[model samples]
Target chain A: MSESDLEEMFTLAVSVAKEAGQIIRDAFDKEKEVDTKLSAADLVTESDQAVEKIVNTRIMEKFPTHRFIGEETTSESGEKHELTDDPTWIIDPIDGTTNFVNRIQEVSFSLGIMVNKKTVIGVVYAPIKDEMFTARLGKGAYLNGMKLQASKITDLKQAVIITEGGSSRDAKEVEDKVKNIHALITHTRGIRAYGSAAVNLCHVAAGRGQGYVEYGIHIWDFIAGALIAKEAGAVVLDPTGCDLDPLRRRILCACSPEVAKGLSQILTHLDMGCD
Target chain B: MSESDLEEMFTLAVSVAKEAGQIIRDAFDKEKEVDTKLSAADLVTESDQAVEKIVNTRIMEKFPTHRFIGEETTSESGEKHELTDDPTWIIDPIDGTTNFVNRIQEVSFSLGIMVNKKTVIGVVYAPIKDEMFTARLGKGAYLNGMKLQASKITDLKQAVIITEGGSSRDAKEVEDKVKNIHALITHTRGIRAYGSAAVNLCHVAAGRGQGYVEYGIHIWDFIAGALIAKEAGAVVLDPTGCDLDPLRRRILCACSPEVAKGLSQILTHLDMGCD
Candidate 1:
């Protein structure tokens, strides 16, 4: 795609994301009716479905030939979807559904466009904070139109990291995650879990946090966020210190390359199982 | 003090908290020079000290005879200040100092007034989110002037828990915290670490979360938030299942009586070491 095409797509993604964010905000004050997905803890709400439908429809209307993948629909069948060479739009209409259902204001709407099997445009809108994070492949990332820069903290001891205990409640997975937390807590300044991968990634992009790592997350959860963080000068990669595979479920993002190396080293030694 | 006097103090506390919050907000966008206190990870910024001074001056100006305890000054001398029969104001001018230093928006200004050795008024102001949580004894909790209520989740499986890994990076403390996290992750709907004890407690009070647990925290870190949560109908206690002693460094707050009972049961079995 041409640079102008990518820019146009980025603009469209931001607008669509804001619209979806408004839907979420409107539904937030009402009573939430939650439904279970893979397990009792893995939740979905009517607002999730409603927002997904709206976002998917709007994107398809703009680019009828573009493929679309959304969390609420794709995860229902328990099948993992892949990004193809053709242009595709990935949407997590309501990232952090658990927080949304619980009436927490940390929820967000994330959207990304992948072309030639690479993310070319991304937008993550957090309505409650009225902060819009947007990025294009070559263009730098931005939060609310102001340019963003990742933190310069290179030492792990001064870094504040973000991670989450994912939807899985399996005893073994929980134990492994806790162990990883134990490993990092001693060396890092602090650990935070916002329960929203997209927001956490954006915070890292904005230099509010130094790093983020999580496993068993889906592509729709962090694709847009990864792009934003990458554009903001962060190193986004898999735990194995390789480029992220869109189909992979693990992510390690850090503000600086040194912090990324330290995190990767710790995670590799721990060798936690993939979901 | 009479009911009207307590009410007046509550009003004064809220105003002073907002003034302190403004000080924090004004300083937030500027350069932050962080200094360490108890440990390297335990940070203090110029903003923290400046805000504390403003809060202390404003409160003391109103009540000249009232005693005052602030995190920055009291902790510097390594003194565990007790809540006495005198009217004492407990202040954590910037509760999430690390977040403040890092430009994270989760910081807050916390103030609680103790009269007759009981918390008679409490206020927590999060400037970035523009949320102010306040409570008075025998009255109730309010978030931005609206009444607040804790969630009614009784079952552990449906509850969302909040916690923080404290400043201590001791091997034993890290292991115990991880174990506690592992134990709770299996039963709770989700686990969140906001890195700000005051914000976490207010979240539970607003029904955005169901429970909160932490260790090695100080009176200034939680005194205001505890009152807000308690007035919102939560049960705030120590790990030993007794009322929180201002000097005690452990806290376990739950939204409902049954959730508190369940959390207390689980925590008692784990028996994590105190800092």
Candidate 2:
């Protein structure tokens, strides 16, 4: 796609994200009615579905031939789930449903557009903070219209890391996360668990946090955020220090290459079963 | 103190907290120069000292004979740090200095007034969120102008809990916290670490979260927040299930009696060496 086309897609994504954020804010003001999805921790609310529908309809209306993948609706079957060379829009109407249901204010609306299997337009809107993050392919990332730059800290001892305890309560994963936390706390300046992958990624993109690592995340959770972080000069990678795989559920993002190398060394040495 | 006296103190606390919050916000805009006191994680900034001085001078000018204990200026020497049966003001100018320094948006200006060793007034101001939580003895807690209420969730399986990895990275404490997290993540709906005791307690008070636990915390960390939570009808206690000791460093707070009992039972069963 051309740069102008990417810019238009980025603009549309930001507007749709803002609209979805409004839906979420309005639903949060009323009494929340939540339902358990896969387990007690995997929650879904009417707002989630409603916001997804609105965002989907709006995007489809503008780009009728484009493929779409949303957390609330994964209607595609078989290999259609895999990213193809065709244009696709990925959306997470409410990235932190638990926080949204609990009115925790760390939730966000994330949207990303991929062309030829590469994210070319990305937007993540945090309504509570009224901060919007946006980026286009080959263009810089921005927060509320200001260009963003990641933090300069290189040492793990001085870096503040953000992560989360995922919805899974599987005994082994929980134990692994605990062990990872123990290791990180001993070496890092601080650890924060905001319960929202998109917000955590944005914090890294905005340079407020130096690093973020999490497992069992989905493409919709960090697709837009990862692009934004990358545009802001962060080094986004998988556990093995290669290019990030959107289909993969693990991520390690750092503001600087040195911090990324440092964290990668720790995780690689610990070997918490991501393989 | 009379009811009217408590009312006056509450108003004064709210106003002073806002002023301190402004000071903190201004200083946050400028380049921060941090100094370490106890450890690498135990950071203090010029904003902390400046805000505390402003709050202390304002309160002392209004109540000349009232005692003051601020995190920055602990004038009381020896055993005087113990809660006395006299009127005193407890303040934490910047409750989450790490968050403030990192620009994470969870920092707060916390202040509490006590009489006869009981907290009678509490005020916590989060400038980034523009939220102010306050409470007066027997008058109930509030966020902004709305009365606050703790979450009615009684089941640990459905309750969101908040905590922090304190400044102390002691091997034993880190191990204990990791163990507790492992145990709680298995039973609770979710866990959040906002890195601010005041914000975490306020989240519990406002019914956004159902529980909060932490160790190695100081009186300045939770003195204001505990009262706010208590006024919102939460059960605040130590691991021993007794009234929380303000001087003590451990706290377990739950929004409902049943949840408190359930958490207390779990902590008691683990007995991770708080004694």
Question: In terms of lDDT, which candidate is strongest?
Answer: 1
Candidate 1 residue lDDT tens string, B1-275: 87777777777888888888888889887888889886888899888888888878887788899899998888677765656799999989899888888778899999988888898888999998899999987789999989999988788888889988777777777777887777778778889988899999999999988999988788888999999999999999886687776776788999987887777777633343332
lDDT of 1 by residue, A1-275 (tens): 78777777777888888888888999987888988987788999888899899888877888898899888888776665756888989989899988887777789999988999899888999997788999988889999999999998899888999988888877777777887788778879889998899999999999988999998888888999999999999999987788887677889999998999999887633343332
Per-residue C-alpha lDDT of model 2 across residues B207-232, encoded as one tens digit per residue: 87889988777788898999899999
Kindly report the docking quality category of candidate 1.
medium
- Going through the candidates in the order shown, the clash numbers are 0, 0
Which residue runs does candidate 2 get wrong by more than 4 Å? A75-80, A268-275, B75-80, B268-275
Predict model 2's lDDT versus the native. Answer: 0.83
Q: How far out, in Å, is residue A52 in model 2?
A: 2.1
lDDT of 2 by residue, A1-275 (tens): 76677667777888888899888878875678888765689888888889889988997898898998898786222233578888899988899988887777788999988889999888999897788998886688999999998887788887888877778887878788877777778778778888889888999998887999988778889999999999999999985688888887789999998888888777632233321
**Candidate 1 chain B, run of 10 with poorest lDDT:** B266-275
Cα deviation of B255 in candidate 1 (Å)?
1.2
